[model samples]
Target chain A: MPRLTARERREGYQREYAFQQRHGKPFFPHVVFHDTIVSLIVVALIMGLSVLWYVQFGAIPTDPMAERTGGLLGPAYEAKADPGVLGYHPQPDWYFFFLFELLRIFKTPQLLIVGTIIIPTIWMVLLIGWPFIDRNPDRRLSRRPIALAIGVMVPIVLLTLTFYGSKVPAEGGAASTEPGAAAFAAGACSTCHVLANAGTAGNVGPVLDEAKPDYATALALITNGQGAMPSFKATYTEDEISCLAGYVATWSAAVGTTPGPGAATAKDYPASCEKAGGLFAGTVSSASGP
Target chain B: MSTLLPPPKEIAMMPVDWVEERSGAISFGKFMLFRNVPKDISWLQTLGSALITVFILQATTGIILAMYYQPTPDTAWMTIQWITNEATLGWLVRGMHKWGSSVMVVLLFLHMGRTFLFGAYKYPREMTWITGAIIFILVMGMSFTGYLLVFDERAYWATIVGVNINGTAPILGPALSYVLMVGPEIGTNTLSRFYSLHMLVLPSAIGGLIFLHMLLVVRLGVTSPPWSRMEPTEGDV
Candidate 1:
C-alpha cells in the first residue's frame, strides 16, 4: 500500500471524526461506564492487597532482634535502617528488578555506566520517539507485524529480567554463631568481600571463598589495603588484623575442602580470636562459656 | 416564570450558573462528558482512566502517610513504625501506597501496550504519546524517590545503590550522585531530599503532564481497536 500523503492524513482524520460522530456512542454513558467499573475494580484490588498484606504480616515486632517474617505479600517493614551496618543485602522493590538485574549483567566498573545510565536513557528515548520511527499508518496487528512483535517482546524481556533479578541471592547469608565469623561480619569485611563461613555474599571486592587468599596475603591486604579496598591498618590493632586475616584464610580455604587438608582447625580460632581482644575476644569468651 | 419567584431548581443552580457564567466550566464539563467516542473501544481502553484513579488514590493516601512521616534520618523509621502499628488504618494506607505503586507501574505498562497495539500514537496523537511517555518516566521517578521514605533496611541500602547507579553517568555521574545524596553519605539531607521529590516535585510534574495527556485524549478522541472493521470513508455525512 502507498504511504498516505499529509493532505490525505488530514482528510482521513476528518472522515474518522464524521464517522465517529455518526456511529459512536456518547462518552458519558458508554466510555464513562466502562472507566468507572475498571476504576472501582482497581480500587477494590488495591484494598484487598492492603488487607492481605497486613493480615499476613501482622504487626511489627516489639523485640527488635526477633525476626519479622512476612507471609505472601512481604513484611510490613524490614528492620530499621542502620548506616553503620553493611551486613544486610540491598534489594530494590520488584518493579525495579529489571534495572537491578541490568546492573548485575554489566558488573565491570567500566561497563556499569552502560547498564545504569546509557541503556535506560536509550530505551526511554526510543519509547518517546516510537511514533515518529514507525511512520507506517497501518494499525491492525496483522498488518503491523513489526510493531506487534516489539510490543510483545518488550514485556516478555522485562518479565524475564524481573524473574531472574528476583532470583539473585540475598547478600550476606544468615549470621553465624562462630566467633571468627562474628568478627569477620562485624569488622565490615562482609561489606566488600564474600566468604562462605561468614555467610557473606558482598560483591564489592573479591570473593574470598573463591580467591582463597592465604594468611600472608590476607594480612597484607587487610593491613595495607589495595586498589579499591580500603586499608584497615588505622582501624584495627596488629593482633586484630592478624585475627581477621587468620579467619579469612581459614574459612576461604576450608570451603569445599575436607577437614584434614588446608582447613584451619577449630583450635586455631580461639587463639587468634583472643589476641584480637575486643568484640572478637568477647565472642570468643561467650563461645567458650564458663 | 418571572412573576414573583423563580423555581427551586433554578435557585439551586444560581451559584453554579454564576460560576459557569464567569468560567465557562459548565459548557466545558458538558463538552468533556458528552463527547463521542469510537463505538468499538474495548475495555482495555479503560486502563488509562484506571491509572488516573490509582494516582488519585496514591495522592490521597500519600497525604495521610505524610502527616505522620518524619523525614529526618533519626526518626523516619520510627515514624513509619508508629504509622503502621499505632495510627488507625495506617497499615491499610501504607500498604495501599506500597502496593498501589506496583499496580500503577503495571497498569502503566499495560496502558502503554494498548496504545502501542492500537497505533494510537501515530500522527495526530504523537504529542499524546510523548506526554504519556514523560508521565511514565516521572512515575518511575516517583517510585525511586518514594522507596527511600520508608527508611527500612532495604529502602536505605537500595537507595544507596540507586543513587550510586545514577552517579555512574559519564560526565555528570559523580556530580549527580553528590546532588542526590547531598553529600558523601545518605544522611539527614538525603532523606529529606527524597521526601520532597517523592511527594512534591514528582507529583506536581506528573499531575501537570497527566492533565496535558488527558486534554490531548479528549481533543483527538479515543482510538478504535485496530482490528475493528471500521474505515474512514471520504464522503460527506
Candidate 2:
C-alpha cells in the first residue's frame, strides 16, 4: 500500500470525524431542516393564536384587586387581571379532555393509577418511540403487519377511551346528591326497581315513586323485610332503612304524604311532599357518574 | 480435461449436521468486539440494538417507579409528590419512565416507517410487522389507561369519555359497560379491573408480542442494505 503523508492522515481523520457526526444520511438533509422548521412554525403559530386572542380580542382581566394594592406596578397587574373568573369551570382543554374525562369516570380512588400514569406513560412511549423500537426494512402494507395493526388499533383505542370519558359524569364537581344511586340503577335495581328518568321499567317490586309510604311503613318494609324487597335490616339501620324506604316511596309519591287520616305535615315540605293522590317520584338521576 | 475434481472428498462425510456450527462459543467480549460477525453488517442494523436497549430502560424504571406509586384517588397525587420529594432519586426514576415512554413510541414509529419505506414487509417478514403493529396498539392502550391512575381532575373526567366509547357497540353497549365497571360506579371494582388490565394483562400481552416480533425479525434476517438489493446476486438470498 502507498504510504500516507502526515497531512494526508490528518485530513483523513477530519473527514472521518465529519462522517461520524452526520451518520451518512446525506449531509444536512433539507428534509431534516425543513421538518424542524415546520414543527417550530406550528408551535409558534399556536402561541401566536393564543396571543392574538389575548391582545386583539382584548384579554379578560384576571384580578381586579391588583389596582388597589397600593403600588405603581399594581395597575399594570390589574390591567392584566379579570377578577372573579373561577377559571372556566376547572377543566382542561380539548386535547387533554379525554384524560380529564377518564378521571371523572374513575370514581373509585383505588383504580386511579390505571388511567393516570400507567396508560398515559405507555401511550407516550409507544407513539414517540415506536419507529425506533420496531426498526424493520419492510415497506409493503401486508408485510409490515405490526405497523398497520398499531396504526389502526391506536386510533380505535384512543377513540374508544375518549368516548367513555365523554359519557362518564364528572365527579365531585357539581355536587352529586347521590351518585351511587346511578350505579344501583345500572343493574342492581334494573329488574325490581323502577325509576323514570333512570329509564328503568322494572315490574317486579312496587314502584319507588308510587309507594309514597311514610317513614314508618318504609322502616317496616326495609327493616322487617317486605315481600320481594328483601330485609336490609342487617345492612341498614332504623334511620338508613327509613331513608331507603322513604327513597323508594318518595320516588313513587312524595314521602310522608299519607292519603290516610293520620299523616305528617304537608305544611313543612310544600315543595317536597305533594301527594294528594300521587305516589313518590324517584329524584335520583343517572346523568351523573364520571 | 474431465478429471472430475478428485470425486469431491469421498471420505465417508457422514452428511454433516447443519446445527453443529451454530453451537459455537459465546461470550460478552465476542459480542462487543464483533468477533462473530459475518463481516456484512452496517449502520442500519443499529436500530434493532437501540430498540432493545431502550426497552430495557423502560421496563426497569417502570417497575421501580411503580413500587412507590399509589393508584387510588385518595393517594395517587399525594404518592406522586412523595416520589418526587421523599424517595431518593424518585423524580429521576419517574422522569425516566415518563420520558422513556415518549422516546419509545417515537422510536417504534420510526422503526415501522423505516421498515415500510424499505419494503422489509415482504415475504417471510409479514407476521413480524403484524406483531409489531399489535404491540404498538397495546402501547397506546396502556397510555390512555394510565392517565386515569393519576386521579387528577382530568383523569376523572376522561374516563367518562372512555366508557361512552366502550358503550358504542351495537347491542351490548350499556350492559357491557355495567359489567366493565362491575357495579356502574367508580368504586373498588372499576379500579381493580383497570389496574389488573393495565399492570397484568397489557404488560403481559406486550411482553409476549415483543418476543414474537423479535423472533420473527431475527428469523427473517435484518433486511439487507438497500445498495445490496440493487446489486442482485445469482442466488438471490
TM-score for all models, in order of appearance: 0.83, 0.43
* Chain B TM-score of every predicted model: 0.94, 0.74
Interface RMSD of each: 3.2, 14.2
Q: Per-candidate RMSD vs. true structure?
A: 5.6, 18.7
Candidate 2 displacement at residue A164 in angstroms: 20
**DockQ for all models, in order?**
0.57, 0.04
Give the CA lDDT, 0 to 100, for residue A269 in model 1: 49
Q: Which stretches of candidate 1 lie over 4 Å from their true place?
A: A64-68, A170-290, B7-9, B231-237
How many Å off is the CA of B21 in candidate 1? 1.6
Query: Largest lDDT belongs to which candidate?
Result: 1
